[model samples]
Target: MKRRDAYLKLTRHNGRAGTHGTYNPKHNDRSFNLANSEHIDPERAKGNIYWDCFYGFRSALAPQDPDDLAATFSEVERQFYESRYSNFVESQNERNAKIRHTERNRSIPDLLSSRKTCPEETIYQLGTLDEHASGEVLLAVVTEFIEEFKARFGDHVHVLDWALHLDESTPHIHERHVFDCENKHGEVAPQQEKALEALGFELPDPGKPLSRRNNRKITFDTACRKMLFEIAKRHGLELEEEAEYGNREYLEKQDFILAKQKEQLAAQQNKLDELTLKVNDMETLIDEVSAAAYDKAVEVVTDVVRTETRKEDMRMIEDTKKWVLSPERKAPQSTREYTAKHLDSVLGQVPQDHADHRCPLAGEAPEAGSPAERQGADQGKSTGFCSATAEPLAGRADPTKAICAAYRRKIRKLFSIIVRGDVY
Candidate 1:
């Protein structure tokens, strides 16, 4: 019979013939004859000859189908051992029942009370060592896997938790998956599964017990190192040989660089604050200067107006003196003196009529005429004097012109208060 057919027939018969002993009957006799013919030493006789015959028997019964015999053996062993081990089976059953009860009673509202909900499912829990790898690369691979996983599965899956445990013997991630029972919208589950598939992880069977799954007990130290390297390769984020060492020197250098950058940023911020304060101070100073300049300009203009008014009044008095003392009004000295005294008395009593009275600069004398004639002569002279001097004083281009021009120049200077530009 062919070796493969013989093994298959033996398996189908439920026979125990080949489980312990060799299937081949002639192998022992053949080895004994070879040892006798070679005159082998006794110690060698007990070792080499026995081992060769044992291996020969094993080879004859070994399956040649190229299937995973180790996996098949493990399954068969589990089934056989579980059937025979009643105590172990009962313990496992009790554990599974408790887990199922917990899952059924747990509500999403209860979970949300203590934990924040994330949009995506199948969160990639990474170790601190894993985070030592490039974050950009890790996130890229993880995101791609999440997308692919969602495409394959529905959107009922959600990541309930993702945490990196760094303060342990082996840095690892703790991840929790929550199946959305109320996933009518189907937005979260499908995309999450798709992303997981892209990351090359086997899809987890929801019906399986949580304790039986490989993901439940995953630790950063015991995780698939090869898979992490593959993810790095996909994203082109592999670290250099020196970086992979993770030595103290490298860590110190990184710290120094980061500290320097922080210091530089702080300095720049401080400089900006100082500049802002300076600008505010300058603005306040400008306002003060502007107020002072405005007040000074007003005072100067008021003084100019008063001085001009006084000079105009003096010129009018001088014109009146010229008109009243003219040769046309010549009179006796004694009569002029008496007329001057009466005019002064009237001018003092009625200050408002001083403008029309005889000028103070006129000689203290009355003209040679009757009382009515003197009065008519004084009235005629006053009108002529006013007409002549009014035109000269009021129409003169230079009248108080210098004072006004100076005031305008001072006003322009005051208005030139410098104001700073605005900060961005």
Candidate 2:
């Protein structure tokens, strides 16, 4: 027998109606026959007859079985009694199927994924009992909630969709929010509290009056952006506008500093180039002077050699040779020859009557004075030669003295020429 049939039999033996004794064709339990009870004594089956009569009357009135009733009529009794369990199961199955279909078509998972990654807040207004409340008032309440949510969730909460479904008699808004659960740590509420604190507002107790709280009201349109701003402010997040301005200022300052540095570097390089050019010019001049001196030295040496080989003035030539080769000589041979030739060249350039030749010992024209004149007089008495206009012969015992004196005079003249800018 089916479980329902067995249940029906047990209820009948206990003198009770199966499903309140109402007949239903769709019911799994077998219907009881009222005529079968007539074969038994009424006195011996009074309890069965009483229950049958009651069920017979109820079936005639209602015309539906209690066990096979629809959900609305059956749920209360079926919930506790477990008599209408199959019907409940069928209803639950229908509900689950509908939910599954809706979820699949809507692509809830994909929507959730998108919301998780998006960095924006979702806002919505909650319905209250007040029907006459302004839209602004509704928005203000929602804005407060948004601020609280931001403080609690920090960067974790992202609002995806928000809509005020005001067509209903009791207007309310739907909101979709996403949390970056993997990135955020700890409880969300505490973080929200911190955010509110930063905004100079304390978390309000739900029971508190709106006027007592620091609640500012706003309309739906006004509330959207304001809610975002409040949330971002509480969490110390930067808005696109502020960040862009900051970046621009930073770049301008950096550019100014770079331009100044470049200018300074260019100036320094210019100065260095100028100094280098001056140094190069000075070095070139020094090299030219040195080479000229070397050539003049070679010329003087050649002249001395020629004079000695020709034997025109053996005594003076021999003395010159001795001076050139002497160990006691302070100057090198090259230096000595260079000085003699240089002096000869300068003397050759000067006129013969130039005062440089007046005294054999005089290196230059003697300063016009008493002491030099007396010295010249004494020298003249010893040498028996006039102090002025008297050229010493090459064969003299001390020919070098005359040459050296002439060389000194020539040097003084050359220095004077250089200082006077005549050499250029």
Candidate 3:
């Protein structure tokens, strides 16, 4: 049995980053500038090509372009913010577009950066570089695997792009895709744990809370590995389900050698050099601590002021609430209710002869037998607001009703202002 291994990793780098450029030599600046580098053989690099993302068969292979993937990312992100976070955009201006904070706050790149898991890369290879399966067989398996992958995760995971590289030590496919789920605002945003959860993936340790060791992504990756292994088995290549340690184990021969050399050199460093490094690190730490302490002190003082201000405001609100809801004080009423319920009580508060209490034309008390005069006589009081003296209008006006309406309007306005905390 020719036992191979399955390789998959969820990297922090998003599609637009330099990693995509490295995967496709056409987009790599280093490939153009440093063609002599051992990592990529110029002649063999010609065989590497991007996946044909079209409906019909292509005459030739499509060349990999990072800009195409980046454009897709940009469009998706633009729609997400424009559709769901319109409030955040509306609150912004030319001066504070980047500074404004709200409930749905995020920067332009946050759609990519804020995600816990980013684009994942899956490599389909038989074995180590020195011993591996034929390129034709690997290609066929990977092509079928990509189809299965799309069917499995197409909903939550979007395949941005993939490339088949023939320039590397072994033939493999470098496929990249982002995970996303609908956020609270109904926007499909790039998120890892939530996306996986939406896809029905559970934590590795169901009993424990989600953490670095007990994440749902860990379970997700395991399922992907199993799928890859099963697909490889179907294609007549037996794959090893054994786990690999060290992230750098999959690097190219030249890069691996350089990494080992760096490790050896670090191990062989002189004590004097190590001491000097520690002393510099200590100085840097001290500077950081001093700056952090000053910032924390300022934050504490500002919080104290804010807390006291809030306490005073709350106290004022409570006082207003008590006065407004008191049983002894009459709640605000309409003009008709005020006249019927508190007409006598309110009239007694003001003396009949007070200039302000009297209407503009106090001399025009209605004729004794007039309806207005009879109403006042029945009340048996001269409260000045009696329609007899209070009518600002000519003969036919009822001034008591007019005064009650004005008072009702003023009372409503005052209550509204108090509830809004605008009294201060």
Candidate 4:
């Protein structure tokens, strides 16, 4: 196996780009870019790791989305104000004509940038692209390192989030935390030196006063780096601790260049994603509008067809009724012949009113001098008899009324068939 170098870089956040979007990505939107399909391989995203232990320190008023370092710092500042600085603020307001703003009236992020506070960030890797450790082994070692760090510094340092990015060329971890300790007012405030001191970290050179190269922070980082190497050893990982001269700066410069490139690419991808979302939304809206319009058109057509069909049917029924009842008009010869044959049966089946106790043909005055009229006159009978039955017609109503009713029924049946598309 190739021997890998154990790497850890501690940082305090500046105004530069951050790692939150790259850590937890909502890929469907533009919330994240570098961690999306454009820069990070989508197929490999499943192997990425995210572990967040910031819930214990998250404020109730914090944003619901993924935590950023700014929000984390704000929470720390809020804790200091609520627990330690509130009383002092109240007393100052009561005593002075010029009231002091709440919680020192300062921004935590500004103080952090100025080095008045510390926001701890560390990126750990066990290998380089050319000679990297196996992902399984690296993960195991990093897991142990995280547990050890938390156990050692839980009292003063709080872990916000940690992400292991496997989609990149090599596996590595980005962990963030904030160091805090009680101040003179007995209120816990974010202060890196006091917290490291509380954790028993001493200056690198005991004989010298605290300075940039001999600070407790340097001592703390050295101890953490040593712990990481020890954990890797237990996991059977061979890592080099000593760095060659000038190698550290070169690697850092390379890392910085790569980061800026990714940021530019991310910016481009974000614009593309926004445009895609707008196009998709417009497509969905058009489809809905088209469907609604189509349904309304169908409804209007159906209503118009139904109204016109009812009117036409009524006109046809009225015309047929007039022809059958008219003494001067007659049906076609074929229709008359068929009707003549079925007339008796049709007459018997039609509904009758018992109150009309008269001849079936009595209601219709036949053409003068017709056979039925002559027969009635010759027989000296006031009522007409059916020509089909040749018997005295009583209690049966008008034949014309029955014939029109039967014709109306047939016409309605035919209209129903036409409406159902069974007939043209």
Largest TM-score belongs to which candidate? 3
What TM-score, computed on C-alpha atoms, does each candidate reach? 0.22, 0.17, 0.44, 0.43
Q: How high a TM-score does candidate 4 get?
A: 0.43
Error of 1 at 151 (Å): 16
lDDT winner among the candidates?
Answer: 4
Candidate 1 structure quality by residue, lDDT tens digits, 1-424:
1232221010001111245431221322122354454333434323211111011111212432445332222232233223333343344446567888533342232222222222211223222332343333334555454344335432444332222222233322222333332223322221223343444445244455434333322321123333444544566543332221223434544576787789999999999999999999999999899779756654654454534433333333333333333455565555444444433443343335344434443443433443334434543444344344334345324323454445334422322221011100
State the lDDT of candidate 4 residue by residue for 1-424, as single tens digits.
Answer: 4443344322212221255412221221112545435666656655666555534322223333564543343453345434543554444445453554454444443434443543445667666676776666676887787788889898998765655667668776666666778778666766788989999999989999988767998888777777877777777655554543335433444466687789999999999999999999999999899779756654554444333333333333223333334445344655544433343333343335421322433444433443323333432321121222222233434343343345445644553432343111
True-structure lDDT of candidate 2: 0.36
Candidate 3 displacement at residue 14 in angstroms:
12
- 2 or 4, greater by lDDT: 4
Tens digit of per-residue lDDT, candidate 2, span 1-424? 1232221010000011234442121111113343454433323222210001012212222343566343221122222223312333344446568888533332222222232221222323222243223344444455466456556544544433233333334333334333332212232221222333343443334455444232321122234455555543443333332211222443443466787789999999999999999999999999899779756654554445333222212222223333433455576667656544544454455445443332343332322323223334433342333211123223324343455355435434553442242111
Write down the lDDT of every candidate, Cα atoms only.
0.36, 0.36, 0.51, 0.53
lDDT of 3 by residue, 271-362 (tens): 66989899999999998997797566545544443333323222222233333333444444343233323323333433344324233323
Higher-scoring candidate on lDDT, 3 or 4: 4
Worst 10 residues of 3 by lDDT: 52-61
Count clashing residue pairs per candidate: 24, 7, 0, 0
